[model samples]
Target: MSSKVYTTESGEVVYAMVAEFETPADVYHAAEKVRDAGYSRWDVHTPFPIHGMEDAMGVKRTILPMVIGVVGLSCAGLGFLMQWWMSGVDYPLMTQGKPFATWQAFVPITFELGILFSAFTAIIGMLFFNRLPQWYHPLLKKDRFLRVSDDRFMICIEAGDANFDPDRTRALLEGAGGKHIDLVEE
Candidate 1:
Protein backbone atom coordinates (compact mmCIF):
# COMPACT_ATOMS: atom_id res chain seq x y z
CA MET A 1 0.00 0.00 0.00
CA SER A 2 1.28 3.46 -0.92
CA SER A 3 1.11 6.15 1.78
CA LYS A 4 0.10 9.50 0.33
CA VAL A 5 1.27 12.66 2.05
CA TYR A 6 -0.04 16.15 1.44
CA THR A 7 1.40 19.55 2.36
CA THR A 8 -1.11 22.16 3.39
CA GLU A 9 -1.08 25.81 2.28
CA SER A 10 0.82 26.56 5.50
CA GLY A 11 3.27 23.75 4.58
CA GLU A 12 2.05 21.50 7.37
CA VAL A 13 1.83 17.76 6.77
CA VAL A 14 -1.60 16.44 7.74
CA TYR A 15 -3.06 13.04 6.89
CA ALA A 16 -4.39 9.90 8.52
CA MET A 17 -4.88 6.28 7.54
CA VAL A 18 -8.21 4.70 8.35
CA ALA A 19 -8.97 1.00 8.63
CA GLU A 20 -12.55 -0.18 8.41
CA PHE A 21 -13.80 -3.24 10.21
CA GLU A 22 -16.77 -5.49 9.64
CA THR A 23 -17.85 -5.50 13.27
CA PRO A 24 -17.35 -3.77 16.61
CA ALA A 25 -15.26 -6.68 17.81
CA ASP A 26 -12.97 -6.27 14.83
CA VAL A 27 -12.51 -2.57 15.60
CA TYR A 28 -12.04 -3.33 19.29
CA HIS A 29 -9.26 -5.77 18.52
CA ALA A 30 -7.77 -3.29 16.09
CA ALA A 31 -7.75 -0.63 18.80
CA GLU A 32 -6.01 -3.04 21.16
CA LYS A 33 -3.36 -3.75 18.58
CA VAL A 34 -2.86 -0.07 17.86
CA ARG A 35 -2.53 0.70 21.55
CA ASP A 36 -0.09 -2.11 22.11
CA ALA A 37 1.87 -0.89 19.12
CA GLY A 38 2.42 2.37 21.11
CA TYR A 39 0.42 4.68 18.91
CA SER A 40 -1.04 7.55 20.96
CA ARG A 41 -2.74 9.64 18.28
CA TRP A 42 -5.23 7.04 17.15
CA ASP A 43 -8.96 6.59 17.69
CA VAL A 44 -11.70 4.06 17.11
CA HIS A 45 -15.18 4.93 15.94
CA THR A 46 -18.32 2.85 16.07
CA PRO A 47 -22.00 3.38 15.55
CA PHE A 48 -22.59 2.67 19.23
CA PRO A 49 -20.63 2.07 22.37
CA ILE A 50 -18.91 -1.30 22.43
CA HIS A 51 -18.40 -3.25 25.63
CA GLY A 52 -14.78 -3.37 26.78
CA MET A 53 -13.76 -1.04 23.97
CA GLU A 54 -12.40 1.55 26.38
CA ASP A 55 -10.03 -1.00 27.88
CA ALA A 56 -9.11 -2.17 24.40
CA MET A 57 -8.31 1.40 23.43
CA GLY A 58 -6.37 1.98 26.66
CA VAL A 59 -8.43 5.07 27.48
CA LYS A 60 -7.75 6.53 30.89
CA ARG A 61 -10.20 8.08 33.33
CA THR A 62 -10.85 11.74 32.61
CA ILE A 63 -9.94 14.52 35.06
CA LEU A 64 -13.02 16.57 34.25
CA PRO A 65 -14.72 15.84 37.53
CA MET A 66 -11.76 17.10 39.50
CA VAL A 67 -11.61 20.26 37.41
CA ILE A 68 -15.30 20.88 37.88
CA GLY A 69 -15.08 20.29 41.61
CA VAL A 70 -12.29 22.83 42.06
CA VAL A 71 -13.94 25.45 39.91
CA GLY A 72 -17.32 24.90 41.51
CA LEU A 73 -15.99 25.21 45.03
CA SER A 74 -14.02 28.32 44.14
CA CYS A 75 -17.06 29.93 42.54
CA ALA A 76 -19.21 29.06 45.54
CA GLY A 77 -16.74 30.67 47.89
CA LEU A 78 -16.52 33.75 45.68
CA GLY A 79 -20.28 33.99 45.51
CA PHE A 80 -20.61 33.84 49.27
CA LEU A 81 -17.87 36.41 49.74
CA MET A 82 -19.47 38.75 47.22
CA GLN A 83 -22.80 38.58 49.03
CA TRP A 84 -21.15 38.99 52.43
CA TRP A 85 -19.14 42.02 51.31
CA MET A 86 -22.17 43.65 49.70
CA SER A 87 -24.50 43.11 52.65
CA GLY A 88 -22.09 43.56 55.57
CA VAL A 89 -19.40 45.98 54.41
CA ASP A 90 -20.56 47.68 51.22
CA TYR A 91 -24.26 48.41 51.78
CA PRO A 92 -25.14 47.04 55.26
CA LEU A 93 -28.83 47.01 54.58
CA MET A 94 -31.10 46.18 57.57
CA THR A 95 -33.89 43.98 56.20
CA GLN A 96 -36.61 43.10 58.81
CA GLY A 97 -33.92 43.39 61.51
CA LYS A 98 -31.96 40.59 59.89
CA PRO A 99 -28.20 40.19 60.41
CA PHE A 100 -25.88 42.08 58.08
CA ALA A 101 -24.14 38.91 56.80
CA THR A 102 -27.01 36.44 56.64
CA TRP A 103 -25.76 32.93 55.92
CA GLN A 104 -29.31 31.73 55.14
CA ALA A 105 -29.83 34.30 52.46
CA PHE A 106 -26.48 33.45 50.87
CA VAL A 107 -27.09 29.70 50.50
CA PRO A 108 -29.28 29.84 47.37
CA ILE A 109 -27.03 32.13 45.38
CA THR A 110 -23.90 30.24 46.44
CA PHE A 111 -25.44 26.93 45.44
CA GLU A 112 -26.57 28.35 42.11
CA LEU A 113 -23.17 29.79 41.38
CA GLY A 114 -21.54 26.47 42.27
CA ILE A 115 -23.83 24.58 39.91
CA LEU A 116 -23.31 27.10 37.18
CA PHE A 117 -19.54 27.01 37.51
CA SER A 118 -19.54 23.21 37.56
CA ALA A 119 -21.71 23.01 34.46
CA PHE A 120 -19.61 25.50 32.55
CA THR A 121 -16.38 23.81 33.64
CA ALA A 122 -17.69 20.43 32.56
CA ILE A 123 -18.65 21.70 29.10
CA ILE A 124 -15.56 23.80 28.46
CA GLY A 125 -13.21 21.20 29.93
CA MET A 126 -14.69 18.42 27.84
CA LEU A 127 -14.51 20.51 24.69
CA PHE A 128 -10.96 21.61 25.41
CA PHE A 129 -9.79 18.10 26.20
CA ASN A 130 -11.58 16.51 23.26
CA ARG A 131 -10.60 19.31 20.84
CA LEU A 132 -14.07 20.31 19.85
CA PRO A 133 -15.51 22.86 17.39
CA GLN A 134 -13.59 21.12 14.66
CA TRP A 135 -15.61 21.68 11.50
CA TYR A 136 -13.66 19.07 9.54
CA HIS A 137 -11.55 15.99 9.93
CA PRO A 138 -9.42 14.03 7.50
CA LEU A 139 -11.31 10.82 8.23
CA LEU A 140 -14.51 12.51 7.04
CA LYS A 141 -13.10 12.44 3.52
CA LYS A 142 -13.04 8.64 3.41
CA ASP A 143 -16.08 7.18 1.67
CA ARG A 144 -16.07 3.99 3.74
CA PHE A 145 -15.97 5.98 6.96
CA LEU A 146 -19.27 7.61 6.06
CA ARG A 147 -20.83 4.36 7.26
CA VAL A 148 -19.26 4.93 10.66
CA SER A 149 -22.47 6.60 11.76
CA ASP A 150 -24.47 3.70 10.40
CA ASP A 151 -22.99 0.21 10.73
CA ARG A 152 -19.26 0.28 10.10
CA PHE A 153 -16.52 0.46 12.71
CA MET A 154 -13.27 2.27 12.01
CA ILE A 155 -9.83 2.90 13.53
CA CYS A 156 -7.73 5.80 12.38
CA ILE A 157 -4.02 6.33 12.99
CA GLU A 158 -3.23 10.00 12.66
CA ALA A 159 -0.05 11.29 11.02
CA GLY A 160 0.71 13.46 14.03
CA ASP A 161 1.32 10.41 16.21
CA ALA A 162 4.86 10.09 17.38
CA ASN A 163 4.99 6.42 16.44
CA PHE A 164 2.98 6.66 13.25
CA ASP A 165 4.53 4.83 10.30
CA PRO A 166 2.15 4.40 7.40
CA ASP A 167 3.44 1.05 6.24
CA ARG A 168 3.94 -0.48 9.65
CA THR A 169 0.69 0.89 11.01
CA ARG A 170 -1.30 -0.39 8.05
CA ALA A 171 0.39 -3.75 8.37
CA LEU A 172 -0.46 -3.86 12.06
CA LEU A 173 -4.09 -3.07 11.38
CA GLU A 174 -4.23 -5.68 8.67
CA GLY A 175 -2.73 -8.23 11.01
CA ALA A 176 -5.37 -7.27 13.56
CA GLY A 177 -8.13 -8.18 11.04
CA GLY A 178 -8.86 -4.77 9.60
CA LYS A 179 -10.48 -4.57 6.14
CA HIS A 180 -11.24 -1.88 3.58
CA ILE A 181 -8.24 0.21 4.57
CA ASP A 182 -8.10 3.74 3.14
CA LEU A 183 -5.81 6.74 3.39
CA VAL A 184 -7.30 10.09 4.40
CA GLU A 185 -5.67 13.37 3.51
CA GLU A 186 -6.14 16.95 4.68
Candidate 2:
Protein backbone atom coordinates (compact mmCIF):
# COMPACT_ATOMS: atom_id res chain seq x y z
CA MET A 1 0.00 0.00 0.00
CA SER A 2 1.30 3.44 -0.94
CA SER A 3 1.53 5.86 1.95
CA LYS A 4 -0.58 8.92 1.14
CA VAL A 5 1.39 12.05 1.90
CA TYR A 6 -0.89 14.52 3.63
CA THR A 7 0.50 18.05 3.38
CA THR A 8 -1.08 21.00 5.11
CA GLU A 9 -0.09 24.58 5.80
CA SER A 10 2.69 25.15 8.31
CA GLY A 11 2.02 23.78 11.84
CA GLU A 12 -0.78 21.51 10.60
CA VAL A 13 -0.50 18.14 12.34
CA VAL A 14 -1.83 14.66 11.73
CA TYR A 15 -4.65 14.08 14.12
CA ALA A 16 -5.65 10.45 13.61
CA MET A 17 -5.78 7.47 11.27
CA VAL A 18 -9.38 6.62 10.47
CA ALA A 19 -10.66 3.32 9.08
CA GLU A 20 -14.03 2.72 7.50
CA PHE A 21 -16.04 -0.39 8.17
CA GLU A 22 -19.33 -1.47 6.72
CA THR A 23 -21.17 -2.96 9.69
CA PRO A 24 -21.30 -2.72 13.43
CA ALA A 25 -19.96 -6.26 13.78
CA ASP A 26 -16.93 -5.38 11.69
CA VAL A 27 -16.26 -2.29 13.73
CA TYR A 28 -16.70 -4.22 16.97
CA HIS A 29 -14.16 -6.82 15.94
CA ALA A 30 -11.82 -4.12 14.66
CA ALA A 31 -12.06 -2.32 18.01
CA GLU A 32 -11.08 -5.54 19.75
CA LYS A 33 -8.03 -5.77 17.50
CA VAL A 34 -7.01 -2.18 18.20
CA ARG A 35 -7.47 -2.70 21.93
CA ASP A 36 -5.43 -5.87 21.91
CA ALA A 37 -2.75 -4.03 19.98
CA GLY A 38 -2.38 -1.78 23.08
CA TYR A 39 -3.17 1.48 21.34
CA SER A 40 -4.72 4.08 23.63
CA ARG A 41 -6.41 7.28 22.45
CA TRP A 42 -8.56 5.43 19.97
CA ASP A 43 -12.31 5.55 19.38
CA VAL A 44 -15.05 3.85 17.41
CA HIS A 45 -17.95 5.78 15.91
CA THR A 46 -21.17 4.15 14.77
CA PRO A 47 -24.48 5.46 13.54
CA PHE A 48 -26.16 3.76 16.50
CA PRO A 49 -25.11 2.23 19.75
CA ILE A 50 -23.85 -1.33 19.67
CA HIS A 51 -24.09 -3.63 22.66
CA GLY A 52 -20.75 -4.75 24.14
CA MET A 53 -18.81 -2.07 22.25
CA GLU A 54 -17.47 -0.59 25.46
CA ASP A 55 -16.13 -3.92 26.61
CA ALA A 56 -14.60 -4.50 23.18
CA MET A 57 -12.87 -1.14 23.39
CA GLY A 58 -11.58 -1.89 26.89
CA VAL A 59 -13.17 1.21 28.40
CA LYS A 60 -12.80 1.57 32.15
CA ARG A 61 -15.47 2.78 34.54
CA THR A 62 -15.83 6.54 35.04
CA ILE A 63 -15.39 8.35 38.38
CA LEU A 64 -18.35 10.67 37.79
CA PRO A 65 -20.45 8.68 40.24
CA MET A 66 -18.02 9.28 43.08
CA VAL A 67 -17.78 12.96 42.20
CA ILE A 68 -21.55 13.35 42.22
CA GLY A 69 -21.80 11.54 45.56
CA VAL A 70 -19.31 13.92 47.18
CA VAL A 71 -20.95 17.02 45.75
CA GLY A 72 -24.42 15.90 46.83
CA LEU A 73 -23.34 15.18 50.41
CA SER A 74 -21.43 18.45 50.69
CA CYS A 75 -24.43 20.46 49.48
CA ALA A 76 -26.70 18.63 51.89
CA GLY A 77 -24.36 19.40 54.76
CA LEU A 78 -24.24 23.06 53.74
CA GLY A 79 -28.01 23.21 53.63
CA PHE A 80 -28.28 21.84 57.15
CA LEU A 81 -25.61 24.22 58.40
CA MET A 82 -27.30 27.21 56.80
CA GLN A 83 -30.65 26.37 58.33
CA TRP A 84 -29.16 25.78 61.79
CA TRP A 85 -27.16 29.01 61.74
CA MET A 86 -30.15 31.06 60.61
CA SER A 87 -32.77 29.66 63.01
CA GLY A 88 -30.58 28.83 66.01
CA VAL A 89 -27.66 31.25 66.03
CA ASP A 90 -28.57 34.26 63.88
CA TYR A 91 -32.17 34.67 64.99
CA PRO A 92 -33.74 32.50 67.67
CA LEU A 93 -37.48 31.98 67.07
CA MET A 94 -39.86 29.99 69.26
CA THR A 95 -43.43 29.15 68.25
CA GLN A 96 -45.88 26.95 70.18
CA GLY A 97 -43.11 26.14 72.66
CA LYS A 98 -41.13 24.38 69.93
CA PRO A 99 -37.30 24.55 69.87
CA PHE A 100 -35.75 27.21 67.65
CA ALA A 101 -33.36 24.67 66.00
CA THR A 102 -35.50 21.90 64.60
CA TRP A 103 -33.95 19.19 62.42
CA GLN A 104 -37.33 18.20 60.97
CA ALA A 105 -37.83 21.54 59.22
CA PHE A 106 -34.42 21.15 57.51
CA VAL A 107 -35.10 17.73 55.99
CA PRO A 108 -36.98 18.93 52.90
CA ILE A 109 -34.47 21.68 52.11
CA THR A 110 -31.48 19.43 52.74
CA PHE A 111 -32.85 16.66 50.52
CA GLU A 112 -33.75 19.12 47.83
CA LEU A 113 -30.32 20.72 47.86
CA GLY A 114 -28.67 17.32 47.70
CA ILE A 115 -30.76 16.33 44.70
CA LEU A 116 -30.17 19.66 43.00
CA PHE A 117 -26.42 19.66 43.46
CA SER A 118 -26.14 16.04 42.40
CA ALA A 119 -28.05 16.72 39.19
CA PHE A 120 -25.93 19.76 38.37
CA THR A 121 -22.75 17.91 39.17
CA ALA A 122 -23.78 15.07 36.89
CA ILE A 123 -24.39 17.39 33.91
CA ILE A 124 -21.28 19.52 34.45
CA GLY A 125 -19.10 16.56 35.21
CA MET A 126 -20.16 14.66 32.11
CA LEU A 127 -19.49 17.65 29.90
CA PHE A 128 -16.13 18.34 31.50
CA PHE A 129 -15.04 14.73 31.33
CA ASN A 130 -16.10 14.34 27.72
CA ARG A 131 -14.49 17.64 26.70
CA LEU A 132 -17.61 19.10 25.19
CA PRO A 133 -18.07 22.30 23.16
CA GLN A 134 -15.61 21.01 20.62
CA TRP A 135 -16.36 23.42 17.81
CA TYR A 136 -14.32 21.56 15.21
CA HIS A 137 -12.57 18.27 14.60
CA PRO A 138 -10.08 17.08 11.98
CA LEU A 139 -12.30 14.18 10.99
CA LEU A 140 -15.13 16.54 10.08
CA LYS A 141 -13.08 17.69 7.09
CA LYS A 142 -13.20 14.26 5.51
CA ASP A 143 -16.10 13.87 3.12
CA ARG A 144 -16.25 10.10 3.68
CA PHE A 145 -16.57 10.61 7.42
CA LEU A 146 -19.96 12.25 6.86
CA ARG A 147 -21.28 8.75 6.32
CA VAL A 148 -20.48 8.06 9.97
CA SER A 149 -23.70 9.77 11.06
CA ASP A 150 -25.73 7.76 8.60
CA ASP A 151 -24.76 4.18 7.69
CA ARG A 152 -20.99 3.75 8.04
CA PHE A 153 -19.04 2.71 11.11
CA MET A 154 -15.52 4.00 11.79
CA ILE A 155 -12.56 3.42 14.07
CA CYS A 156 -10.03 6.15 14.65
CA ILE A 157 -6.59 5.59 16.12
CA GLU A 158 -5.24 8.93 17.16
CA ALA A 159 -1.68 9.85 16.23
CA GLY A 160 -1.15 10.75 19.88
CA ASP A 161 -1.43 7.12 20.84
CA ALA A 162 1.81 5.71 22.18
CA ASN A 163 1.60 2.74 19.81
CA PHE A 164 0.78 4.81 16.76
CA ASP A 165 2.91 4.38 13.62
CA PRO A 166 1.51 5.62 10.34
CA ASP A 167 2.47 2.55 8.33
CA ARG A 168 1.81 -0.01 11.04
CA THR A 169 -1.51 1.55 12.04
CA ARG A 170 -2.75 1.58 8.48
CA ALA A 171 -1.73 -2.01 8.08
CA LEU A 172 -3.49 -2.96 11.28
CA LEU A 173 -6.67 -1.32 10.13
CA GLU A 174 -6.48 -3.10 6.79
CA GLY A 175 -5.85 -6.39 8.51
CA ALA A 176 -8.94 -5.80 10.60
CA GLY A 177 -10.96 -5.57 7.36
CA GLY A 178 -11.05 -1.80 7.34
CA LYS A 179 -11.37 -0.03 3.98
CA HIS A 180 -10.53 3.47 2.80
CA ILE A 181 -8.18 4.08 5.71
CA ASP A 182 -7.27 7.76 5.69
CA LEU A 183 -4.98 9.92 7.70
CA VAL A 184 -6.75 12.90 9.22
CA GLU A 185 -5.02 16.18 9.89
CA GLU A 186 -5.49 18.89 12.44
Candidate 3:
Protein backbone atom coordinates (compact mmCIF):
# COMPACT_ATOMS: atom_id res chain seq x y z
CA MET A 1 0.00 0.00 0.00
CA SER A 2 1.10 3.55 -0.69
CA SER A 3 2.24 5.62 2.32
CA LYS A 4 -0.25 8.27 3.31
CA VAL A 5 0.95 11.55 4.81
CA TYR A 6 -1.13 13.72 7.11
CA THR A 7 -1.15 17.47 6.81
CA THR A 8 -2.81 20.42 8.45
CA GLU A 9 -5.80 22.26 7.03
CA SER A 10 -3.43 24.72 5.39
CA GLY A 11 -1.21 21.86 4.22
CA GLU A 12 1.37 22.84 6.81
CA VAL A 13 3.05 19.67 8.06
CA VAL A 14 2.72 16.55 10.15
CA TYR A 15 3.61 17.04 13.76
CA ALA A 16 3.86 13.52 15.20
CA MET A 17 2.27 10.10 15.49
CA VAL A 18 0.38 9.50 18.71
CA ALA A 19 -0.58 6.06 19.98
CA GLU A 20 -2.79 5.13 22.93
CA PHE A 21 -2.24 2.41 25.50
CA GLU A 22 -4.56 1.16 28.20
CA THR A 23 -2.00 0.65 30.99
CA PRO A 24 1.22 2.11 32.30
CA ALA A 25 2.97 -1.20 31.87
CA ASP A 26 1.91 -1.29 28.25
CA VAL A 27 3.28 2.21 27.65
CA TYR A 28 6.42 1.52 29.63
CA HIS A 29 7.31 -1.55 27.58
CA ALA A 30 6.39 0.29 24.42
CA ALA A 31 8.76 3.09 25.36
CA GLU A 32 11.55 0.55 25.78
CA LYS A 33 10.97 -0.86 22.36
CA VAL A 34 10.84 2.58 20.79
CA ARG A 35 14.06 3.52 22.54
CA ASP A 36 15.88 0.32 21.56
CA ALA A 37 14.74 0.85 17.98
CA GLY A 38 16.84 4.08 17.94
CA TYR A 39 14.01 6.55 17.75
CA SER A 40 15.07 9.64 19.69
CA ARG A 41 12.23 12.04 19.10
CA TRP A 42 9.51 10.32 21.02
CA ASP A 43 7.82 10.66 24.43
CA VAL A 44 5.37 8.82 26.65
CA HIS A 45 2.47 10.28 28.60
CA THR A 46 0.61 8.66 31.44
CA PRO A 47 -1.87 9.57 34.16
CA PHE A 48 0.61 8.72 36.91
CA PRO A 49 4.27 8.03 37.39
CA ILE A 50 5.62 4.66 36.34
CA HIS A 51 8.67 3.18 38.06
CA GLY A 52 11.81 2.84 35.91
CA MET A 53 10.20 4.76 33.07
CA GLU A 54 13.32 6.85 32.65
CA ASP A 55 15.47 3.79 31.99
CA ALA A 56 12.87 2.43 29.65
CA MET A 57 12.86 5.66 27.68
CA GLY A 58 16.65 5.95 27.82
CA VAL A 59 16.38 9.46 29.25
CA LYS A 60 19.74 10.87 30.24
CA ARG A 61 20.51 12.96 33.29
CA THR A 62 19.86 16.66 32.94
CA ILE A 63 22.72 19.20 33.13
CA LEU A 64 20.81 21.62 35.31
CA PRO A 65 22.67 20.67 38.47
CA MET A 66 26.02 21.22 36.77
CA VAL A 67 24.89 24.58 35.47
CA ILE A 68 23.64 25.63 38.90
CA GLY A 69 26.90 24.60 40.58
CA VAL A 70 29.02 26.54 38.11
CA VAL A 71 26.89 29.64 38.33
CA GLY A 72 26.81 29.49 42.13
CA LEU A 73 30.58 29.19 42.41
CA SER A 74 31.17 31.99 39.94
CA CYS A 75 28.80 34.31 41.76
CA ALA A 76 30.40 33.49 45.09
CA GLY A 77 33.82 34.27 43.70
CA LEU A 78 32.56 37.57 42.32
CA GLY A 79 31.10 38.43 45.71
CA PHE A 80 34.43 37.78 47.42
CA LEU A 81 36.31 39.81 44.83
CA MET A 82 33.90 42.72 45.18
CA GLN A 83 34.32 42.74 48.94
CA TRP A 84 38.11 42.54 48.69
CA TRP A 85 38.35 45.32 46.12
CA MET A 86 36.02 47.59 48.04
CA SER A 87 37.57 47.05 51.45
CA GLY A 88 41.23 46.69 50.46
CA VAL A 89 41.82 48.38 47.12
CA ASP A 90 38.89 50.65 46.32
CA TYR A 91 37.77 52.25 49.58
CA PRO A 92 40.65 51.16 51.81
CA LEU A 93 38.53 51.39 54.94
CA MET A 94 40.19 50.54 58.25
CA THR A 95 37.52 49.10 60.57
CA GLN A 96 38.28 48.50 64.28
CA GLY A 97 42.02 48.25 63.53
CA LYS A 98 41.19 45.16 61.46
CA PRO A 99 43.16 44.70 58.24
CA PHE A 100 41.36 45.57 55.07
CA ALA A 101 40.41 42.62 52.75
CA THR A 102 39.61 40.55 55.83
CA TRP A 103 38.75 37.06 54.64
CA GLN A 104 36.39 36.40 57.55
CA ALA A 105 34.16 39.32 56.76
CA PHE A 106 33.41 38.09 53.22
CA VAL A 107 32.17 34.66 54.24
CA PRO A 108 28.54 35.49 54.94
CA ILE A 109 28.02 37.55 51.81
CA THR A 110 29.84 34.99 49.70
CA PHE A 111 27.70 32.17 51.03
CA GLU A 112 24.54 34.18 50.59
CA LEU A 113 25.46 35.08 47.04
CA GLY A 114 26.21 31.48 46.22
CA ILE A 115 22.90 30.29 47.62
CA LEU A 116 20.95 33.05 45.89
CA PHE A 117 22.61 32.50 42.54
CA SER A 118 22.18 28.75 42.79
CA ALA A 119 18.48 29.12 43.51
CA PHE A 120 17.99 31.49 40.59
CA THR A 121 19.99 29.28 38.29
CA ALA A 122 17.88 26.27 39.27
CA ILE A 123 14.66 28.08 38.41
CA ILE A 124 15.87 29.53 35.13
CA GLY A 125 17.67 26.38 34.08
CA MET A 126 14.58 24.29 34.74
CA LEU A 127 12.44 26.57 32.59
CA PHE A 128 15.01 26.68 29.80
CA PHE A 129 15.69 22.97 29.77
CA ASN A 130 12.03 22.02 29.90
CA ARG A 131 11.18 24.50 27.10
CA LEU A 132 8.55 25.89 29.43
CA PRO A 133 6.31 28.95 29.11
CA GLN A 134 5.12 27.26 25.98
CA TRP A 135 1.51 28.37 25.94
CA TYR A 136 0.56 26.12 23.03
CA HIS A 137 1.63 22.80 21.52
CA PRO A 138 0.44 20.84 18.51
CA LEU A 139 -0.32 17.85 20.70
CA LEU A 140 -2.95 19.89 22.54
CA LYS A 141 -4.93 19.87 19.34
CA LYS A 142 -5.41 16.11 19.51
CA ASP A 143 -8.57 15.25 21.40
CA ARG A 144 -7.36 11.77 22.26
CA PHE A 145 -4.22 13.16 23.89
CA LEU A 146 -6.35 14.80 26.57
CA ARG A 147 -7.07 11.37 27.96
CA VAL A 148 -3.47 11.23 29.07
CA SER A 149 -4.45 13.15 32.18
CA ASP A 150 -7.09 10.59 32.97
CA ASP A 151 -6.72 6.80 32.63
CA ARG A 152 -5.04 6.48 29.23
CA PHE A 153 -1.36 6.30 28.40
CA MET A 154 0.18 7.47 25.15
CA ILE A 155 3.36 7.66 23.13
CA CYS A 156 4.13 10.27 20.52
CA ILE A 157 6.86 9.84 17.92
CA GLU A 158 7.70 13.14 16.31
CA ALA A 159 8.08 13.45 12.55
CA GLY A 160 11.38 15.26 13.10
CA ASP A 161 13.18 12.03 14.04
CA ALA A 162 15.69 10.97 11.38
CA ASN A 163 14.49 7.37 11.43
CA PHE A 164 10.80 8.25 11.33
CA ASP A 165 8.89 6.72 8.44
CA PRO A 166 5.13 6.96 8.41
CA ASP A 167 4.38 3.35 7.59
CA ARG A 168 7.20 1.87 9.66
CA THR A 169 6.39 4.08 12.66
CA ARG A 170 2.75 3.13 12.52
CA ALA A 171 3.71 -0.53 12.27
CA LEU A 172 6.06 -0.19 15.19
CA LEU A 173 3.36 1.37 17.31
CA GLU A 174 1.00 -1.41 16.34
CA GLY A 175 3.58 -4.02 17.20
CA ALA A 176 4.02 -2.39 20.57
CA GLY A 177 0.30 -2.85 21.22
CA GLY A 178 -0.54 0.82 20.77
CA LYS A 179 -4.12 1.50 19.78
CA HIS A 180 -5.90 4.57 18.38
CA ILE A 181 -2.81 5.49 16.45
CA ASP A 182 -3.25 8.87 14.80
CA LEU A 183 -1.05 11.32 12.98
CA VAL A 184 -0.96 14.79 14.48
CA GLU A 185 -0.37 17.79 12.28
CA GLU A 186 1.27 21.05 13.01
User: Candidate 3 on 1-186: residue-level lDDT in tens?
Assistant: 125455656787898999999988899999999999999988998888799999999999888999999999999999999999988998998779999889999999999999999999999999999899898999988899998998999999988888788889999999999999988988
lDDT of 2 by residue, 73-108 (tens): 999999999999999889999877889999998899
Clashing pairs in 1: none
lDDT, residue 60, candidate 2 = 95
Error of 1 at 167 (Å): 2.5
Compared with the true structure, all predictions reach lDDT values of 0.85, 0.90, 0.91
List, residue by residue over 57-161, the lDDT tens digit for candidate 1: 899988999999999999999999999999999999998999999999999999999999999999999999989978797777678888999999988888777
Report clash pairs, candidate 2.
none
The C-alpha TM-scores of every prediction are 0.86, 0.88, 0.85
List the lowest-lDDT window of 10 residues for candidate 2. Answer: 1-10
